[model samples]
Target chain A: MPENEFEKKLKKMMDDFHLPPSTSVWENVSRRLHEKRRRKIPFFFLLAAGLITAGYFTYHVSEKYKQNSTAAISYTGKNADKAGNYLLKDSAKLSTQKPGIKKEEKASVSNTLPGTQQKIFKNELNNKLITVKNSTALKDNSSELENDNAGNNKQHLNGQIINENNNAIVSNNETLFKNSITIKQPVTPADAENTLLKDEVQDNNLALKKDSISGLANQPGNSLKKSTTKTPVTINKTSNWQWGVTGLYAKSNLIENLTNLNIPSAQYSNDPLTSGNYDTAFKTTHAFSPSAAYAFGTVVKKKIFKNGYLSSGLNFIHLSVKADIGKTVDSVIVIPSPAYTYFVRGYAQPGFVKTNTSKYNFIELPVLFQQNFFHSKKTSLSYNAGFSVRQLISSSSLIYNQINNIYFSKEELLRKTQFQVAAGLSFEMNTGKNNSFFIGPQFTYSLSNLIKNPGNSSFHFINYGLQAGFLLHKK
Target chain B: MDYKNLVRNCLKGNAEAQKYLYNHFAASMFGVCYRYTKSVTDAEDVLQEGFIKVFNNLHRYRHEGELQAWMRRIMVNTALTYLKQNKHYSSELSYEEINLHPVSSENPVITLQAKELADLIRQLPTGCQTIFNLHAVEGYTHVEIGEMLGIHEGTSRSQYARARSIMVGWIEKRNENIKQRRYAGK
Candidate 1:
């Protein structure tokens, strides 16, 4: 290059010296873009197909849940006498927000009518109020208790116990209520009269008498009227959710065995794992996968259907497979092996066997039937049997090196996609609307081998896993 | 000048094209960030965060005449966030008490090698390096740099001119050193 021209060009380059990021970064990104589009080729169609299948599943599992439930509704003989009125109600009221302690005190008092529990709560409240008004020393303690009450109610499990102020009341009655309830002898008449008088004095300005509300079945015309504090009795709703989570272990073959005994390669290389040995040259193993699932969709629920949750979402899957690329070992013989023999070790043929490590990541979709027990109520035990499709997202491949740092010859390794059927049992959690977490165990059978193996199929290698997870949905 | 098209392309999710726009102007823009920050890593962080802001708010880019100026504003703001985060983590280091080294002038251009020029530019003690890049490469006025960096205008000018004069002096001394070695070889 000429000096002047070089200088001019150098100047231009100096004037425009911008460093761009490497092309490989973009190549990897664009490659992903193309792969994404390629995968999407069947995405909409599969989604539609899934929607229809899920719709059918959504329909029939619901029908099945109904069929199973109606048949099983009376499944539990806990009460053949009480029959359908089984009240396993999981309900709580927002009690602490009742504006005043008086209402709360009254409710407890009414429920006490002739009952020892009510008298105990009433005496506790009066002593607490008198203690609050009387002592300057106790004033500090009472206010402190009140402050502590509000904080704990907010932390209570059910919405009903949100009474922070109740803690102060409990603290005041701490010594009185802490004793055991079951007694060796009933209270004497004098003791009972004293308890009644204390209850009467405290009822000085209150409107309703405690006796009328007690023994609800015995309450006459005025009993038809409900007290403001008397909460509506809760009976568990028939629409219950099913959920569960599980962990799995699976072992499969990298290749399917060639069925024909007379085929050229079938008898040509006489290895018993190929012929009769259960241990094929290649082995696939999957370990420790946990998943949780829940079923929802109410038409089936209303009918007391067995299965109704049609679900789709992401699964963080870690799958590893080890491919042993050598002649079959002796112990795994499952084929008719008159022609082949197996070796525990040492090569029958002289070549380094190629071994490839496979790791897989996936997203799973399951459409299943969710069922309830004999009766549909607040909580139900449920199980699901469904077709599951897992899409591979990311995979890691391990390449082994020889002394020369050369890769083992692989005329193998790559194989077919999977079509699987999964059966699982889940414990459902329906806190509100469409929110839930399902925990359970699932078993999967791949109709199509991820890697094919043979000899009249040495027996099926299926995946056994546990699943636990949560999902978001429209209300 | 090209702000409208750049914002449009970025909003359309053209990543390669967006990266192109960043590369096209990041160094010159980085000089803007460096003027405020005390270190290269901080400046680079500010630059990255600034671009993230630019990308996220591309839709709000309403036909501004100077895209670089708009980006400069964001970079300045990002640098301020760095300062705030730094201040929150550690009480601001009181540079107020320490005196700055007085700058001297000695032109040292002729002795520079290609690799040495890049390296030396990289080494100008972050504060002066940035002022130098802004004045020499990015064509910013000292007043603009000062306003954006929150330094006095005269300080910006002095830092810029001092950065150049120091580079010239270093280059000259290097040339002399090379000459002495050559003579010794002979």
Candidate 2:
């Protein structure tokens, strides 16, 4: 068999051959392209709807957390304050009465007469015995009292009555002194009897005077002590358990600076296939506009020390960023390849105006330690430092290539999770009882790349925000 | 429309220009696909798929070569991909089978139309038909066909020879039938 005749004939036959295709082929291709375009429209609409729904849910949850926390704090504060004030007043009154009793006992012992000291001593000793017995009975009755107001003041009054018994001994010494001077003429039994009768009457008068003094002390002690004790309890309980809801708004920006790989200008221009002057410098300009961000969460703060607290909570955050990237290529080359014999092709050097808008949604867990530097009844200043672990729930990036007139969308390009460090300073003004309105300036710096691709231009997001919240302190 | 204008409009997503481009090139490209596939319906499927790829990748055409040739390359590549995916051609070949010759027969060359010749070529085994079409009609060397089909160059040569012998036998048998019909008419 010879190749010459067959090859020549077949070449001639195929060179002029043409076979018509069915019309339905173009219809199917057109329909598929239309379907592709239609597919993208609903995806964008669904994304927008999801974002709105999440935002609505976050708002209601934040509001509900704030109301519940505020009510719980106020209730706890009032109850604990009432209990603390009652204890403080009782302790103060007992402390003040102990000294008064000692002074009266010393006075009674020193003022006794020497001549009738023996007989006067017997009456004074009997009066001291009776006073001690009466004081013990009063103490027992006072301890048995159960009324909130009455029980608190009765213990103080009983202490005062015991002091008055010491005063009774002093009154007996005075009666003896007067009797000895007036009845100096005789040492008779009748004189002694008259003195005893007069002493008994004096003792009765002293008991009535002591009772009036105790009544006077009880009235003022209850009124004056109640007012003084309440102020300190409120101030001391400021660092107790607290909860709050912060609505956050932030201005976010990316730190993007890409290192360009420089190739020699002469190398590109001297190639025979290249037809243009080449620029050695390869520079990319990244224009970043301020991106809006929002976050809200319920935070629980437990007082761990006098001025320090530990806080943790679940926070939902939405961060959006827009970046315009511009790059110019120096030269374009055409390499004629025998493998792809139809076209002379090389690397495409189309200058692109790539505008990228990225939105990220995350549920974050923030663990923070806060310390109050300055605290007062009306205002407080505090600073907190913390780290947060954020799980990415959803993300989307829309990239527009102006040179190609193409729009591409990518979802979940970022990593599934990210970490960040945050620090803030808060200025809180006491707005009502156990409640404060706080405004804080907070800063967050990302610790890891938010995206999965390492070759993608590195983006470090620095977020600065004003955090406004209602803080409720527990007792 | 001119080639450059047609391509530029297609790049701009002009539906009319795309349909014009498809109408202009579908017949010639289908000729290329028809030679590679087993039937006209299979060829039509390949033609539709190839044009879709061409439209999608029009931006990469560069316009440095003839538009027909670029489209021809895409169609060829698409046909090869279809054959590989469908396993119409066996990838494995035995050395003993390549050496085996067709039994010789006494037949004369018969003048046949191109369509009849293509039908005779399609009658050969799938591997031989592909090698023969690539080497003879498409003007590719044994080395290029081997690279495309992932076989050795010697194997492509052997397969092309066998396809040529089979087609010659079919043409001889057709010519003998024509002689008998003439004798019966007498």
Candidate 3:
């Protein structure tokens, strides 16, 4: 072909030239379309989780405040006279004892008493009944009091009944008056057992005294009427904030459609003398293989409502994908230039047995709301849902070109940031106080395209995997 | 599907219609991408991005011209944008730097496949390739190309001329190699 003819032919051939993109391109586009649709849907799950958590916390705190206020009111009213009588008896017992008891010893004695007795003791001490005593017998008596309480019916005694029990009154007076100065002695387990035995004996004596007091209260001469008011015991429940670290593993596959594109082809004849005509058409197809992804991160969670929590965390993720482009051309013809004379043998056919491997690293931030549906002392089951933002830290790809007989590697031009939605269920086992081990299955779907070029295949990743971690909590 | 119905369905966000449109024109559009980019992968990137723009902005089509022509224009603009953003092309090329020597053959001719010709074109400088593609293949005038590329019209013509001269020299050398190979074989 001459220069002018060649130019004209080239123009005509260029119009007919068609080269189909790799199949992964459509997959990329489809993935991006799905992401756009997902992003378009309002974050209703997150909003609902937030509203429910807020309502629960508000209701719970209000109920607790109401209970506390009611308890305060009852303590100050209706029980006032009974508390006054107990305070008078405590003052009388303290005055009868030695007058030199140390304040530190008094504090230790107060600390050792049971909850109800400690309140009565605090009231008596507040009424100016303090005495400084450096006596070993007083220490012994306080230890005896502790043992008596420890060995008793495992129930709290009422404040009003402390003065009414005759044997308890006698023990209190003896502990106060006895000033025997025993020298320092080594404490032994046998001595401790003996002390416990003595405590049991005192408890028996107290029971008898309680019987006597009941008899007296029934008598018409008794001025103090038996108090009928019963104080309810309240158990305090404290919620804690927890933090954890997790390692995760996932497997993902590319979702896309397969399509072929046409390329220029040449038909060869058997005769060496005749040149071949470029009438044939060639085509190629592309596909992706499954890939594995890994991630690790730390999370901090705060208890919001009863059995509910809000958590946020940062994660580092590594993702990889492999793609293959199949057979494209049948052969190439080399023609020497000057005379347009060339011997053509089948050579340099564009067979695209090529693989492209792409890897990405990202920093992800996630906010989630978790609710515990079932719980026990040792175990609980919960569900969580949230959204996350992922920023690409780095991305790279290695391309194997069979025709070129070389490996090409380069940094990929991917989107700097992406978004995802995540939801999961977890089973937590309380291993110790304020500590737990949790294992769960989680699912994450991309809400944005991974590549920068909108014209390129839109790549999105869907990951599902098991996440396990240990949580430490502070109340 | 016919182009009119396909366009209507695509406007309604019909996936099948979109796929049909893509399948129908992906190859020819890819050829245009290949002419502008450095590698097949880069070309595929341009093709995908171009189609996305086409799909997203389909409602803007007023049916004023051929659909292929409209899409081709988008692909060209997209390729140019990719080049500019990635800094793949230099800002300018001086006329003195270009090989302006003309080949001696009065009626020089060479036999080459379309793919081979495209490869030779890819070997040209980025500025020359953009100018040649816009002027010769895409049928854009120097004035239009200059407006699109933000350069002078004369600069576009000069770049195209330099590209043509380089290609002619390559063809002459290729022809000489063939003649020598034939003589050696004989």
Model 2 Cα lDDT, one tens digit per residue, A196-298: 3323322222111122213222331111122222232111112256798988899876554213322111112222233122443333333345589999998
- TM-scores for all candidates: the values are 0.33, 0.38, 0.39
| lDDT tens digits, residue span A58-166, model 1 | 5665555333222111112222222221111000111122233345443432232212222111110111111111111232343443443343333221133222233
Q: Is the docking of candidate 1 incorrect, acceptable, medium or high quality?
A: incorrect
- Report backbone clashes per prediction: 61, 0, 19
Which candidate, 1 or 3, would have the higher DockQ against the true structure?
3
Q: Assess each prediction's global lDDT (C-alpha) against the native.
A: 0.41, 0.54, 0.56
Tell me how each candidate scores on DockQ against the true complex: 0.02, 0.22, 0.24
- In model 3, what lDDT does residue A269 have? 26
The positional error of residue A460 in candidate 1, measured at the CA in angstroms, is 20
Model 1 misplaced stretches (Cα beyond 4 Å): A1-16, A19-368, A371-423, A426-475, B1-61, B65-99, B105-116, B123-169, B175-186
User: Which residues of candidate 3, in runs, are more than 4 Å off?
Assistant: A1-475, B1-5, B11-13, B37-42, B56-66, B81-126, B141-154, B166-186
TM-score of 1: 0.33
Evaluated against the true structure, the overall lDDT of model 1 is: 0.41
Candidate 1 true-interface contact recovery: 0.01
CAPRI class assigned to model 3: acceptable
